[model samples]
Target: MRGVPGRLRPRSLRTRLVLIATVLATAAVLVCQATGLTLMRSWLIGQVDDRLTDFRPPSPVFRDIADGTAPVRRPPPHEALPSDFRVYFYDAEGRLLPDSLGSGRSEPRLARTIGDGLPEDGRPATVPAEDGDGDWRVVADPGPDGMRAVVALPLDSVRDATSRLLWFSLAVGAVTAAGVVLLGGAAVSLGLRPLTRVEHTARSITSGELEQNVADTSPDTEVGRLGLAFNTMLDQLRAALHRKDRTERGLRRFMADAGHELRTPLTSLQGFAELLLHDPHMSRSRRREAHELIAQNADRMSRLVDSLFLLAKLGDAPTTEHGPVDLLSLAADGIAASAVRHPARRVTLAPLTAGGVGDSGELDVVEGRGDPHQLAQVLSNLLDNACTHTPPGARLQVRVGSLRAGPRTGGTERPGRTGANPPLPSGTPVHVVEVADDGPGLSPQDAQQVFDRFYRAPPAAGVSGDSGSGLGLAIASTIAEAHGGRLELDTGPGEGCTFRLLLPAGRP
Candidate 1:
């Protein structure tokens, strides 16, 4: 047999509301019914007690016969006792007296024993008995001549009344519960109407309607508070959308300017190439000049295109990778390469002693599962940036070390000391790399925007213009994020800037 498909079944709000209301109403009705039944039972018992008190024998002759002072004989006519009741007389010898009116069945032995013990003051005593049909209550009182008078009342009438009352009350409670459920469902739906409106409004906003706001004019209630919160969220969303739009427009304009820059170089290269091709008979010095012009412009255009491609790739690269990387080695290689590329700049490395999770002298070598190439690119970008912005012969310091941080600590130990205690163990490691320059640093405002793409600081006084593609720091930041690390800059006007890269140094 095929199995049934598993799917979520949504419950109707109306039905749920109705069911809840019905449960509450049923509980209340049951409480009321129980109380009513208790009082009704008490009232019925009192009525039965009063009837027993007021019972009397039929006549003087019948009373005499019941007392056993007269012989068995026919008695005078007498009115009947109440419905469900019967009268019987028995003598002191336990024989049926002549005035008895019920069927000829013998009196119960318990009823006779009760009659015999009746007080002379005529106080009635009640005893249980059964008529030919069902159970009855028998009350016995002594007469003046040693005879006893007994009256019996059937219980069927009271039982029938109680049963009818119970059924009727149940019917009424069920009807009331149904009414409450219906009305309660409608009320709940009306109460939730504002939430429905808010949901629709949010959907509309998500479908490109940025100016929409939730309705906030309702009375002060939970729905009103919800509406107010929704309106505030829309306001924040609007501001975010505006910022995103501005960024997109700025990016378009930047691309246009870059395109113009590339086009100018290409146009110059093409014009010079055509001139050299058509003027093969020209002088050697003129030909050499034309070729140099073409080559220089072509080289410049290639560099610009390469920078643009690098920035685009950085922006679009995936942020997750799965492979172990040696961060320490990567940083060392990047610093050495950048120093070689910028021969005039001075680059220095400070060795870090690892002392935590592992005992290795280096902090677990800052091993992590990531893309090494991307990490190297990030380091290269930071280094290139430091070289380009700082003055010639400026000292660039790169330091790597481990520190104690985070919630847990573990690892091996490495033997070393800066001053007093040996270096920390390996497992308890937090890797950090700081790249500082002793050149003119950025102002506070410039430092804040330095990591933003296409942002460059104002020209420094008494120095040649900066040579940069303006995306180096931004690309570095993107790479840091991919490795679950952060790139932070510390700088102020006239105080050199230090760029720090902090990452966890352990197995991920």
Candidate 2:
């Protein structure tokens, strides 16, 4: 019951268009038909009135009848006058003249009505028939000797003609309206086909078919433009859904990994505390060792929790104090730290330009805009990751340079940048810091998501039990992005890995 109006209404666009067009066309046709019929009926009635006005009786006979001088034989009214016409006579005193024209067939007895009201003027007028048959177009004519004669023509023929034409016009109008509806519906459907396709695509997408796309993307027509926009929206929505799914999966994995990491430390702390509590006869040295172990595990859990909190903050909106930073200086510091941390590994700063090799003074200063502390941390993390994954004595190089004109800032590669030296506008210099290491490079699959939180690649074959939490690279990536920079990895199996941090250069 609630849906009755919805079901009865023209809900579809095509139906509404056709229905509206047909209604308007039908109205216009009806108006024209009415106008034409009215004019034609008026003209027909005018002709009848003209005939009535021009009517004349036989002059001699009328004069004789007026003078009452001759009683000559005369034809009856029906025989003398046209079949559809009648005649009535009146004396000078406006009284009916009965048996005036040898009244045969008694011409509907209109004498009293015509004689009482009709004037001696030669104009026609319409009056009701005395016999109640129909209307009559009557005109009064003044004869000789103050005599008056009235001529009336029945309007039945005009009425019948107009009636026939009205029905005919209605029939033709109905046919034309039907044609308009059929043809208009077809045209409207054809015109709306692109929109229909877009609707179908949208429906399919709502049903979890994210790959659906509208086909008509031409920019020529309105529907074509709509299709293009619809397709673009679909693409964006699909990408958003993919990002959401990926994010959900990553969150689940992060929870699992964080729990596992925290659980180990918690278990260690619990076990050590229980040992100290239960072992009343234990030696002082053993109790102190247990206390130290508990503290270490507690510290590990605290660090893990801190990393998780930091990641949450970074993921939402990371706030940083910006300043001019020298990538070269940061790279040098990272190299030095790596050397001290992994004493056996050789860590050095590599010169980017041809002029300098093994000399820090000769290299150009790669200045950028970022939080100095965050940038330093990113460099440190990259270096540490390199040393942790590589074997001892592996040579790691930190290369820093500035591109005079290169890809745009924020890691978007400019179009038509196929050449090694692509022509680009020179402004907003970009700083590049590469931390390259001679280690087992990540597989393609691993490199794809290396920056994801809690994601860790398999350690090198010789390395075992690397106890580092995997938030270093993820945090570094987030910080770089927060500073409007990006960290990219260029690596392949057996080719070693190069983690490149690109930052927008700042004014010195």
Best by TM-score: 2
* lDDT (Cα atoms) of all candidates against the true structure: 0.66, 0.75
TM-score of decoy 2: 0.76
Which candidate has the top score in lDDT? 2
True-structure Cα RMSD, model 1: 12.1
* Model 1 lDDT at residue 339: 69
Per-residue lDDT of candidate 1, residues 96-203 (tens digit): 544555443334324334344532344434444444443455566765556667676555566677778889789978898888877887888887788788889989
Among residues 3 or more apart in sequence or in different chains, the pairs in candidate 2 whose N, CA or C atoms overlap within 3 Å are: none
Per-residue lDDT of candidate 2, residues 78-175 (tens digit): 56654566666777777766534433333443546443566547878777766766677878887776767778777888889999999988998899
